[model samples]
Target: MDEAAVKEFIGTEISRSTVVVERSAIAFFASAVLDDDPVYTNADEASARGFEAIPAPPTFPFVMQNWGAFAELQAEGGQGAGLGMVLGPLMANGGLILHGEQAFVYHQPVLAGQTLTGVGVIKDAYVKESKGTTMTFVVAETTWSDASGAPVVTTTFNIIHRK
Candidate 1:
């Protein structure tokens, strides 16, 4: 892995996506994740729990890019330039990329019927040697905000490339 080449992407914006949180999608995700919480499925229960609408699961923001309205945006190339634009060139010679870790910071509750805009940026990049293999780690952060531009969730994840 070319550490210097990968480092060039640090502090760069890699992806921007718009996701419309739907109630049906939230119900499906909650079911798939084995979360049988009524608040995730019943709007009345959610409201009684002090939420304005159905509340998404804690880690729901991570999958927002794969489902919801983001799916349509992805087809139309609305996912900005994508992560491939940053990692593709660095791995042209062939290397393995792996997901390392992920975390989320919630500033406010994410309801099922809100639209969010996510902006991703490369936070940092570095290289390390383990068992004689060179590994390059890249840290990326994405902040999802509501229509009024208030942050709902900020997700940080790590991607590792090895050759």
Candidate 2:
């Protein structure tokens, strides 16, 4: 299908997946990213420092949740318009004002060995004209919570599909 055809289909709710947080995964994330924060690395240090356990960095959940959602969306026959299609208008366009703006409220710090479930949904979609072409923006919002039903985090993303 063409870009406009896909853009028209943008408003559909895409997919959702749940992720269980694991200590090993957290450790690997911290180490791979070269983050030496004790709250993410050393459990003893975290406990000694008065945390429940090693807590993940604020943006760490994105690593675990967003990519999976994107993969699922693509696998379900979504096309990549471009980097802007995957990211947003700023990155796709040549504007110097591109910024990553995500608002997340953590009800509880993610602790080591805790399995957090992430529930994702494609929240909204719309088309906007840019220059001489049309761009479709899809917003996906995902909420993560512990098994006990306590909220963990929520991420709303804008994916722009250009035609």
Candidate 3:
């Protein structure tokens, strides 16, 4: 689809997937963050501290939410203006900034053994011209909830498609 067609598809509900939080995944996340916090690493310490299981870091939800949503979109053959395209045009015209703004709200901390189902939708889209290049901005919002129906987190990411 062309840019306009893609924009028209904005606000369309896209995909949903369920992810089970495993102990190994949690440990991997902890290692990635270099977080020495006992709450995320020491299971015994976490339980002693009254946590049922290791509490995932705040940003950990992105691993399952953002990347998962992107994978879903790509699987559906959605066109994406990649980073290379953004940089190539910018380099030709001195430079340009493609800033991505993300905001999230956490209703509950993710814990191991819990299953989170993520639902995502395209929220908005528009285009702007700067320095002789057109930039299409798409905003998508995703909500994740645990199997018990408790809200886990919500995220919104702004993607810039440059031309």
Candidate 4:
């Protein structure tokens, strides 16, 4: 798609996935990132530090958002979908995908075993036309909320596609 077509998707809903935040997911993420914070995987340590449960690390929601991508991939019968899968359509042409920036805002602590739903939307899409090449900047945000519908986290992802 060209710039106009890409911009038309600015307000489109990309994906939504809900998962019951659990110990395994949190532990795995912490280990994979080499985060030594005990609060992310040990309930006892968290409680000792004044937390009611094993609290998710600050960047947990960002990783948790991948559930939506994986779900979409499964629906399409793809072999597998992990991180970075949400941008499948945009990257179909082998364009250079750069993770530009990321920001996070947390309204409340996300604890283990809490059912949370996250929805991703195309917040902004703009194209930078340069000589002989086109670059697109896509900013997507995912709002994660608890079962009661109260937003607990908001994450902004800035992705750049160069073709």
Candidate closest to the true structure, highest lDDT: 1
Model 3 error, position 98 (Å): 6.0
Local distance difference test scores for all models: 0.86, 0.60, 0.68, 0.76
Q: For model 2, what is the alpha-carbon lDDT of residue 163?
A: 52
Quote model 1's TM-score. Answer: 0.90
**Global CA lDDT of candidate 3, please?**
0.68
Residue range with the least summed lDDT across 10 consecutive positions in model 4: 73-82
Q: Which lDDT tens digits does candidate 4 get at residues 1-163?
A: 6778778878777766776677778888888888988777677899999877788878888876553334432323342232244456668887888989999999999888677877778899888988977788889888888889999999899988888
- What is the per-residue lDDT of model 2 for residues 1-163, given as tens digits with 9 covering 90 to 100? 2345444444444434545556767777888888877667777888998888777777778777533333432333443232343344334454232233455666778776666666555565555677976655566666777778788788666555555
Instruction: Return the candidate ranking by TM-score, descending.
Output: 1, 4, 3, 2
Clashes of 2: 0
Give the candidate number with the greatest TM-score: 1
- RMSD of candidates 1 onward, in order: 2.3, 6.7, 6.0, 4.4
User: Candidate 3 — which residues are off by over 4 angstroms?
Assistant: 1-4, 65-99
Candidate 3 residue lDDT tens string, 37-118: 7778788987998888888877787776433333343334343333333234334644344557888898977887777777
Show model 1 residue runs off by greater than 4 Å: 70-77
For all predicted structures, in order, the TM-scores are 0.90, 0.66, 0.74, 0.81
User: Model 1 Cα displacement at 123 (Å)?
Assistant: 0.3
Tens-digit per-residue lDDT, 78-131, candidate 1: 677767876786588778989999999999998987889899999999999899
